[model samples]
Target: MESKKKEKKALGLAELVAIALGGMVGGGIFTILGVSVSIIGFMTPVAILIGGVFALLAAYSYVKLGVYYKDEGATYSFYKRTYPKIPFLSSMIGWFVIFGYISTIALYAFTFSSYMISGSDLAESIWARKLIAIGVIAVFALINAWSVNGMGKTEDFLVYTKLLILAAIAFIFFQNGTMPVSEFFGKLQVDWEQSHVMSILIVSSLTFVAYEGFQLVINGVNEMSQPEKKIPGAIYIAVFLVILIYVVISFAAMLAIPSEEIIAKKEFSLAAGAGKIIGIWGTRLVIVGAVLATSSAISGTLFGSSRQMAVIAGDGFFPRILARRKNGIPRIGIITMAVTASTLILVGGLELILEFGSVTFLVVSLLMAIANFQIRKQTNSSTILTLLAILCLATGTVLIFYYEYTHQWEQLLFIVFIYVILTVFSWFFSIREKRRLHREEFPK
Candidate 1:
């Protein structure tokens, strides 16, 4: 093991809740909101609500497992309990959980740079934007590297600020937007007013991903004070809060701007939409909020990714160095995650990365939900909830792949290609590990 370091103290329920909130309140809200609304128009809120239901179902699966396992595996943990023999595949899927967050962090860095450059009218300076993004990543990593407590406080404070800003956006939207509630409600179905059902579903699934933030809470089970009871409560609260905030914020953004404007800009593109209602300074303020929301999302994701890596390495699957902790921080894992995410950034275009990432993440969640159903047969938690999680995950998976086929086959295949490559590499690692063990035993 790297440095033979011991596991750090368990994180408290509040800290875990903050982690969950930070993940759910991630960088996407400000950026994707504009995109979803612009494409689907006012019906964006309905779409989010639809996504929210699935989120809650997924949350219940984790909530149930979190109370029991209180381990770091998240989805993989449940699977490990079932299929102990082929844990490599389970772990590979667990890697997707990390991949989703790490990629999102990269998105945050890029988005933050975009806003800083846009707000400063320096969008043309590519070098400066890249430098600033690196700086943002360094700043957050350094903070968490110093103290986990600092991350907890940072997320808590950011959560409140983020929520208040969202509330303010709703107020600005209600006061000045010309779009009627009737018009908003009418946009619910696929029609000429918006796009086709496939377009709406793709956007909805993308929007559904915004709800992926609840997965952040899984890590909290290990961190919570009264994990058995408190962690589940926190999950419900965070999921509910995420749903409410997203619904309100999306409604306002769509009302204030045309659907076309929203799709082009996405999430924090709310600044411009809000600007139409509250003026330039008001929009600028929202930009500042977007920076916080997006950056905090990165910080939370970094922390979660690091923790997952440390746990994985400790299990003897990965290089022992990844388990090393300095000042209670897995610096190696953090660096590795940062490097991995930045590498993905070279792919460019937020929508593509997030879309592909969502597919992988949703599949993992489906696996986790299914695991929960199997576990419930062996445990005592509500069978109803486990069944609900299964149904929700199934619906999401069907919609996700359906949207994939219904849109562009090549793009979807490209994502499947990435997963296949990773699986192949995982197989190689397993075979090599087995050979090394055999050599150690016989000294041949």
Candidate 2:
């Protein structure tokens, strides 16, 4: 009976780390690779490494808070609990985080669709891609609604299998190099001087989105054993692994593919590069890897973010219906997230979705860092490290907006508009909750 009970609890450290990696390694890498290469040329790996450093800084506070609170509510819960007096701030974080996940869901689904149709006649058809994006979200939302154990096992399989495939792809790039390794290094040195320092930092800031999903591990605090240990361990290990995978893959893509072509097919650069270098089979393999990567991302995001949404709704910060769950799974929240993400995919372009997700998460992570810093003594966190985390995240947030302002001012305005709308809704809910509390305190 003891053995059977242990077997039923399938998400050990390995599985939890897999969830984090599955979430972190999705469409962000595929989408950002070409853009990074275009901006920094062969020095793209350097930018990726810098991005990893920023991710580590951001993770420090998250791990501290995760260990301190041990709430499955993760981001929103931590903030709300830390400063109970500011209910509106917590509501804003909840809305921002959920919508952030929604945007990334759209991002992963769009990337999946891009690679799904990479070799087909409908590859250039925007409507066809959008339709497939919606279909994939619906499929994964159902999978999440079905069972937690099933989602864990599926995530483990997809995460590890995609890692293997990505490793194999990297190996192929090195073994069947179109250009000599020396030539690639030479290009890097030449590009190094031509590339502005700000450009590399900007690219690094953009890559933060690739590291967004590692926090999903905290959402599994309810199911996992010894979360205080597992949450921090899983998150740190997962972030390191994702950095390795991304750096290796980015280097390989640059070595195998020309910069011009990479920039040309920015949406599906990996597939395009593999097709050019290794022919049709390589392209097909990359497509398979991308499909698995995005599928697991969609699954993990829906699973984790929906639970947070349900928790927020229970607190009266969102719709009460979202609080309903079956067997500990938030089915309605999952479905609602899927629908909203699908709507985003239909209406928004890939760049808009990606940038919105990136900015939203950066802002949310910055808040987490501040929350952890406020309770650093209680959480037993290094105050210096926590403050550094705050500094780095704050800088990254500013850099992202600066990048947008310089390059795409229109999109910057659109993002600002969205934040305003979310803040207004959050304020409305917070006020209502306060009034209700006041009534309960002294009933008329």
Leading candidate by lDDT: 2
Per-model TM values vs. the true structure: 0.89, 0.96
Q: What is the C-alpha RMSD of each candidate to the true structure, in Å?
A: 3.6, 1.9
Model 2 residue pairs with clashes: none
**Model 2 misplaced stretches (Cα beyond 4 Å):** 1-10
> Could you tell me the TM-score of candidate 1?
0.89
Worst 10 residues of 2 by lDDT: 2-11
In terms of TM-score, the best-performing candidate is: 2
Q: What would the per-residue lDDT of candidate 2 be over residues 1-444, giving only the tens digit for each residue?
A: 775445435468988888899889887777888788878888889999999999998888889999889888899999999999889999999998998898889988988988888768998999999999999999989888987788888889999999999999998887766878799889899989999987888888899988988889998787778888899999999999999999988887777777898889885778777887779998898899999999999998888899899999999999889999886788999999999999988787657656778899888889999999899899998988988888888888999999999999999988888889999999999899889889999998
Cα lDDT of candidate 2 equals 0.88
User: Mind giving the per-residue lDDT tens digits that candidate 1 earns over 1-444?
Assistant: 533222243466666666777777766677667666655665667777777887787777777777778776566666667677786776676566666677678777887887876856687887677677777887888777777667777877877787787687778887777888787666655443556765556566676667676666665344445567776877798889888888887776667777787777665467877777778977887877777777767887787778777776665556779989876678888888877776666556555667767887777777877777777755565788778777767777787788678766877887778677777765665666667777989895
